[model samples]
Target: MTSTAPVPDPSPTATTPASAASRGARSLARLGVHVVGDGVDVVVLASQASAVDLVLLGEDGERRTGLLRARHGLWHAHVPDVSAGTRYGLRVHGEWNPAAGQLHNPDKLLLDPYARALTGEVSYVPEIFGHHVTDAAATHHGLEVRDDRDSAPFVPHGVVLPASDPVATAERLAARPRVPWSRTVIYEAHVRGFTLLHPDLPPELRGTYAGLAHPAVIEHLRRLGVTTIELLPIHAFATEHAIAARDLPNYWGYSTLSYFAPEPSYATRASRDAGAEAVVAEVRAMVDALHAAGIEVVLDVVYNHTCEGGLDGPLLSWRGLDNTGYYLHDGGTPARYADVTGTGNSLDFRRQRVVQLTLDSLRYWAGEIGVDGFRFDLAVTLGRKAGEFEPDHPFLVALASDPVLADVKLVAEPWDVGPSGWRTGEFAPPMHEWNDRYRDSVRRFWLADAKALAQGGHGTPHDLRDLATRLSGSADMFHRFDRGPTASINYVTAHDGFTLADLVTYDHKHNGANREDNRDGSDNNLSWNHGVEGRVESGSPGSELRPVRRRSIRNVLGTLLVSAGTPMLTAGDEFGRTQQGNNNAYCQDSPISWVDWERTGWQDDLLETARHLLELRHAHPVMRPTRFAYGRPRSNDPFIDLAWFGEDGAAVEGSAWHNPYRRVLQMRRAGGAAANPRSAEGVAAPVRRDLLVVVNGALNDVDVALAPSRTQGWELVWDSVWESPRERHESAVVDGAFPDAGTVVPVEPLSIRFYLSR
Candidate 1:
């Protein structure tokens, strides 16, 4: 993963609380270090740890080791004179019993999972591993050999949160942007990447949380009309061993180290130097600013797995403290882990302690840090208890019942790398799930179909059928529980795959720079390069294929914003940001991974196109229905909420719906009154309008006859053929006139046209 910038220099170790050995460990509070006036209370949950040592390091390399008393499963101690900025680490002692999964290595300094901030990076080195990971051990299977080397210097230390203000936190929460699910337009962005290269921001603020909260950045989001910014993981995360070994940082932050801590690397340099308190304050301030701007902040959280990785992975925190209790193991072989997340290890939600940690962290972020919501990565893993998904899983139920998160946004990636992991619509209501089917359908229709037809072939018969279902909020998939279109978080591109720009420019992923033989990213991208590739062959005045490619982008964006479900626009996608064809540039923490803010003419045009489409969406409630239309969809009655049609403007009934060669699709959706899910106002907001959408995926121009309606004329809202979003609809609709029923609109090949009839 390329970095937004050289991660503002590693923070210096901060001061910590004084410690006193109580002989017999006891606790008044829960796990992690807690400030109590001048003193501090520290507790660690290490059921398998035979002994626990509290190590507090000083500014000049001095260390004070105190032995904590152990109770049933908790090891705790009381320390006098709580330091405002304290640095501490825990060392657990026990026998190295691999079979039973008891990997307690006293020599390894472990991070507190609940620590609010981290002071340094976890260097990828053999000294940090619990087992003997030296070069010579490679031949002798050193992973099984318990290492005796002290890992204190190489690992990061937990920074005690300075005294906090409950009032400030409460104020932030009270001011939350609480955009209801039905009206949410999520802009999936990275805190660093979003403003890393923004020309308008101060150099000091760029790439930090402060940069994302900058007015310039906020203005862009406001102009784009995204209600919520679902930032990629901001939790304290570490680079994976392999990535670190290659001298690369973990740009995406999927390998979370502290669920409670904000990644210090993402803080401004002064804040990083100021230690944990400043880091947390910066993030909180970022949230406050976003909320002030009427934008919600949703964190992309990784509770399903950790940086500890596989069975042979390092014992950083959980593995060394409570190995068996924190992670899921094979039923028969406790030594082996169940790799459901493809990240080597998965946390065991079945364990009460694990679930408690997750809930506690969530509460801290929501109640104290004041984040708007969370988007759970690999969320299917969290719902798996007895090796299968359960919609009524304890964690899911707990989230729904939690007062703090009940109304807050809760989005699920809804799948993992495990068996039967494709549980798209399996999550219960109140938690919108990522709609990959929506993504694939849109990609196939506008992009894949174009490629197929260019080669004198046709798309599948089920293509239109699947797209129709997606456009209607995936009723065939989510209606089982009556979770409406808003339950589907619609997106055509995301951080992990090709950007919207790359999707139209690259036919295949170019990840050779990742040193993985170009085999790292997914091969089934469902993308089509418009005859030209690789950044438009720079300096070409007018690439003939450029207009067509831009039209495809507009077509896709038009489909997304106008679709029934909630939409998520990937950062930089609004202006056609490119990752240079490296879809899986997870390790490229360089310019390729960061959002390129400088835009070309076409890029700027694309951004306007995005804003125009979002304007249409925000202006009309029919564009974002909270509930599926309850009326019969197949009826030709003018009053029907949703009706499907063809090029001739007649109802596309019977075999016409399954015609393989039929590339054009017309949809007539009249927005109707439904219970607006925004309950805070005590009354349902207006969600009424009428819309006519015509999509042409065919190779040749089609004379699309407008669908007839009883009550009105259609006003042209958007046309994909325009080089500029502000450009007038040339052939699609007449200038300054509304086309009535049966009017012939000359729709372009492979384009989308949206009409307003209200």
Candidate 2:
């Protein structure tokens, strides 16, 4: 990749952790080094060494050794003759000290930091593991002995390639489809699982890189009205040690090994030599195809930690090259790793070189791979320094300033296992964060409390008002920043937790299938199993849960899409796909997490309802909040335009904030100047009131008085109470003032309704 900035100031101190490897190796006769890019020709310089040799390997496994060129305090070689596609590794001649983090046995071949392609999967072995012990307890602390066995046979070798014009590639890709934050609808999906069960995909292409670029995949997204597809982590990851022993793999792709290369396992035709580059090109082509159809691709990235485990972890690229420099080490000792990422060691951003490495990797993916955006996994770790998490951390600041990545979508998981980890709305402006409040509030209002509301006579109006606040772009969370409604990414479920289907079917997490003994998932799900837990008998009306489950799904899904801010839907939620009660299926690559393309008769109706809701969102400008709405901007409007109303249609007062049974939410998205004064819909210019959304979450029927509009006619645009197609009524109701606003509209328990003034 082409860097706009001048080469980072040449360092004199070698204060960086890699200094240890350089100092120790120089004293030995076998230590050797060579520079490939912008410097002097071959010249070997050794002050205390007995001998040194440079080793370069090619695709045919032939090794070429030459004397290294000596430069200012280091060996140098300008191999402009060595074009791209060269596969090479380093063999340092030095002492193998296990305690000093400098294990240069010369038998272990190391990967290059700038390598673009990796030949195969990096297999873990006792020799490559930092420790010398076969015992589990001794290795856990990272103090293990070094084995003499050659790990090169099992280790994946990095491939070199000729440099390409990164600037031109970025320019063309940037011009592709890039919907603004407000208009973007994210569809979170696993590349393999998404198309693995897709019957329409070609047999040869199914579950591969080619399958994602297929027309059928594009059509499905187009019909769903998705602006971006948020793919799960695609970087090459490893199966956890425990899972490997159990014969299962890390299905979520969280353990990243190669940051620049895509996983070759997902490709159909693979070659040990150029397979990674081919897969990268194919994935890039998929992005191009999606862009042509007006869709963007956002990768879920893992940068908090590498596939390398704690202390006794495998010596992959980072550890093999420079363990102390790549990972955050203790300030006093420098040997102990700072375990902030929870998944072993955290990447040390304190060093400028480390920060550059991360930014360089990000630029390579965005500029070279052609992705539209990235959702940082455990973003809190990225902002963390030695002691505190700074919002203006260099990595984030650099990313925001870089020309190629500045315009691309930047999302944050926003929390980590570190101290004070929940920084939801704390991201800098222009960065949208996942809204957990929206998810929790929607769940409590629609599903959990629906049972009490159905029994009648006890629910309050405060609950409904709070629900409306989340529906209004979570103004409380983003109200502090200039970033409008686009700051919140609203959703009911995400990949880390339960699927939407499981949210209603099971009251608690069923993760025994994960082999973690049901110990890996969350406990506070706030889910309500209507009557029987898990799946009930088919067509058995005997369970009171049937109607309630259906109603809850409709209300939550409707609220998510119609609510302010961008909405993200987990794949398979539209068709009611379930994990069969398993909440955490991170280790299961099978059908458990895959979308079951075949749906039951009733499920088809649910899918249609989801489609209709998305269509309605596209049809109405009010549902998609272009700008955040501040309550009552106009003094003349009696209702405050977007006022909170009690069940009686009166303005809710002080006591409503804590009301548990409150199940009626009324929103008058009126007030604000419309930009287009000539549009027939009157939405072009923000007039006083364009749309009103009334949500009823009670179990028994309740009469909600719609505010009587004297000047306009009220028409029903969409209702989630009834099934699709027959869902909305054709005419308008001209009801006069409050108490008797409209006809006694019976809002079924856990239902959402949308009305527009004609």
Candidate 3:
């Protein structure tokens, strides 16, 4: 039973209007249904609605409706006998005028904007839409009339969850790895794709969050030495209409439906059957397990937009409630949305309420769900106010100042499909950005440049200079705000692009599997096919170039790890996972997207190389610096913090960096002198690493001379020419096996060598 009990006089507070449509949304702090004094306090934010009613469904399918009283732009009602797991929906009554941007439909059931748990999946039928679908003339005219069909059967219900225990939440937070950014190695992965085909997991557990936390999965990640696992979106999402029409669901989970609810699709069938609580519990368990393994979990959040598509999109959660308030729209058309995220209507961060919603969801995930951090997808959309990207936007300011997110690691995808959206190094402090320049430079140096040389082309001028800048740190892009090199999240391969193996095998993207007539995906793949186009076994015909391909992969891997930035390794890249040249496999849910666990002999060797590279990186502070390596240290340190060298072991200066055909560049650094971070005892002591990195970007071998060493000879720490990391085959490690100062050594073609002074 439901009772429309009197709402207590809430403390009315107000803030400055963020947008023109924010007139009705006046600081309604209690926007969602909350369990409070007596029974439940249901506060729905429908500032412009003429009438609002709460509908509760009984376990036996009985319904109870109660009218919510409107006050100060908020609809409020205190209901009796409401408990946890109660299924409910809202019927917001207002005129449905599409031209005027008012999409309120009294007949259609709406979802609570702050629903913590959702009960059902939205059926993408005509009934779920706001406009009349059956009426031929009405539909053609575009909202000449509203769809009067009862949408109760098509839409999902908002589920109430039991409040969290403070003690348990605190305990979870305390167990976080909290790894320093300098020492952090991120492994980007998708929960379903990570363990979907793992042979050790039970069939029932496959493709579920439970499987992601399995011992085997944890063991693999631990062995990879990745401190943080940045998962692809796990928010409750609905497959797009176009993708669903083809009977293939959205594999990337970017089309988010609800921010608070965890995606039940990635949970076990048993967990789904148990209830939404069980699904949530499964996610928490996965997080707890990852934390126990000393690994942090970071979510890829799509707050820039919702699953609801463009102007004529479906009436999901936000659309039906308050169209103009939640979404950014053109003032001229009012009905037309400002699509910045390319996923359709962009969420208006200009409004305080929307900012509040995102902040609340983040806090819930951090406090209640026990996750570490978040990576904002299409993050430029978040900083867009008045249709222009602003670095000092209030939304970003709130994030920087929020106590809940103070220590939280924030990463920005840093671009959108909107105008002038390529703002890579423009995000505020504490927000690391995905450095596309670094990715392109590394790919070009190891793949495209090699391809150019092999084809008798020298490529673009200043290519070597750009590469040298990226090798040290792209300070030209990030140093404006004094944001250090760690602000750059350097990655060559992500979930979107070609896998590490595909980068070497396919020069072009083969995305015919997407049924787009091979027109989809980017054409600018900076890749090289080593003589052949398709997969070639080790001993198969035309497989002689396989070793060359492996060399290219090793060069890229070594460069990415040895560079001065926060390196992110795409899952399966360490062992050369491929997508059969399907770069944009967003619709692929089969083996094309899942990480193949079956390893070949060469793949085992590649994995060992990745492990060795990570070990070297972690052991030496010179490889990863928190501040810029080019810092003018406040302390009087004699060691040169950073220095670049040419093939002659001399400093690379002036126009010499612009030589495109100049394939050899060396970087040398001393530990503790770069950033000069004080020791735990507040003393700046000399760090004990004499690191030197040499890369030969040419297709042919070259002899490079070792730099002058004060104490002793240079030790052979690592070289990309070694097919196996442990088994040097022909080379030896350190101690007289290495050459003395100023000695020229034969550097392999398309390889990088790491040396430490003995």
Best lDDT among the predictions, by candidate number: 3
lDDT of 3 by residue, 1-758 (tens): 11122332222221122321243233246567766544566677776666767777776873444444455556665666678888888877776777778888766788788888887887767777777775211223366557778888877788887777899999999998899999989999999998888999999999999999999999999988899999999999888766666667789999989989998889999998988889899999999999999999999999998887775556777888888889998786537888888777899998878998899999999888999999999999999989899999999999999998888789999999998999999997989999999999888778887887787775652358788788787898888677889999999999999999999999999988888888888898999997689788768898899999988889889999988899999999999999999999999998889999999998999999999999889888877876677533325455677777888888888888766778888787766443455778988755466788988887778888776664467778888988987755357743246677678887878889998876
Pick the winner on TM-score between candidates 1 and 3: 3
* Candidate 2: segments with Cα more than 4 A from true spot: 1-55, 58-76, 80-83, 92-105, 135-144, 165-171, 270-274, 332-334, 451-465, 540-544, 634-641, 678-689, 729-743
Of 1 and 3, the candidate ahead on lDDT is 3
Tell me each candidate's TM-score. 0.92, 0.86, 0.93
Worst 10 residues of 3 by lDDT: 12-21
Task: Note the clash tally of each candidate.
Answer: 14, 29, 0
Off by over 4 Å in 1: 1-29, 60-72, 136-140, 458-462, 538-542, 633-638, 673-688, 729-736
Sorted on TM-score, best first, the list reads 3, 1, 2
| TM-score of candidate 1 versus the correct structure, residues matched by position | 0.92
lDDT of 1 by residue, 128-165 (tens): 88777764123224355788788888888998877668
Worst 10 residues of 2 by lDDT: 1-10
* Model 3, position 691: C-alpha lDDT score: 81
Which parts of model 3 are misplaced by more than 4 Å?
1-28, 70-72, 134-141, 458-462, 631-636, 673-687, 733-736
Best by TM-score: 3
Better of 2 and 3 by lDDT: 3
Residues 1-758 of candidate 2 have per-residue lDDT tens digits of 11111222222312233433344354322122222354212333222222233445664664544333233223433333454555565444433444555444345665555455667666655655544546422335545345556667766666554455658686657666878886889999998898998899877777877788899988988987888999998877777565666667889999887777677777756432345557667777777888888989899999888877776666655665456667776654425677877877888777665676677777877887778899998888888887578889888788789887877899988888877888888888656899998888888777666644444634442355558788888888876667788789998898867777788888888887777778887887867777568877667754666666776787788889888988999998987888987877888998898888888876888888888878877777767876666565554333444556655666666777567656676777763444555577644443533676777766557787775543355567667766663545322233322223454566665677777666
Measured on C-alpha atoms, candidate 3 has an lDDT of 0.82
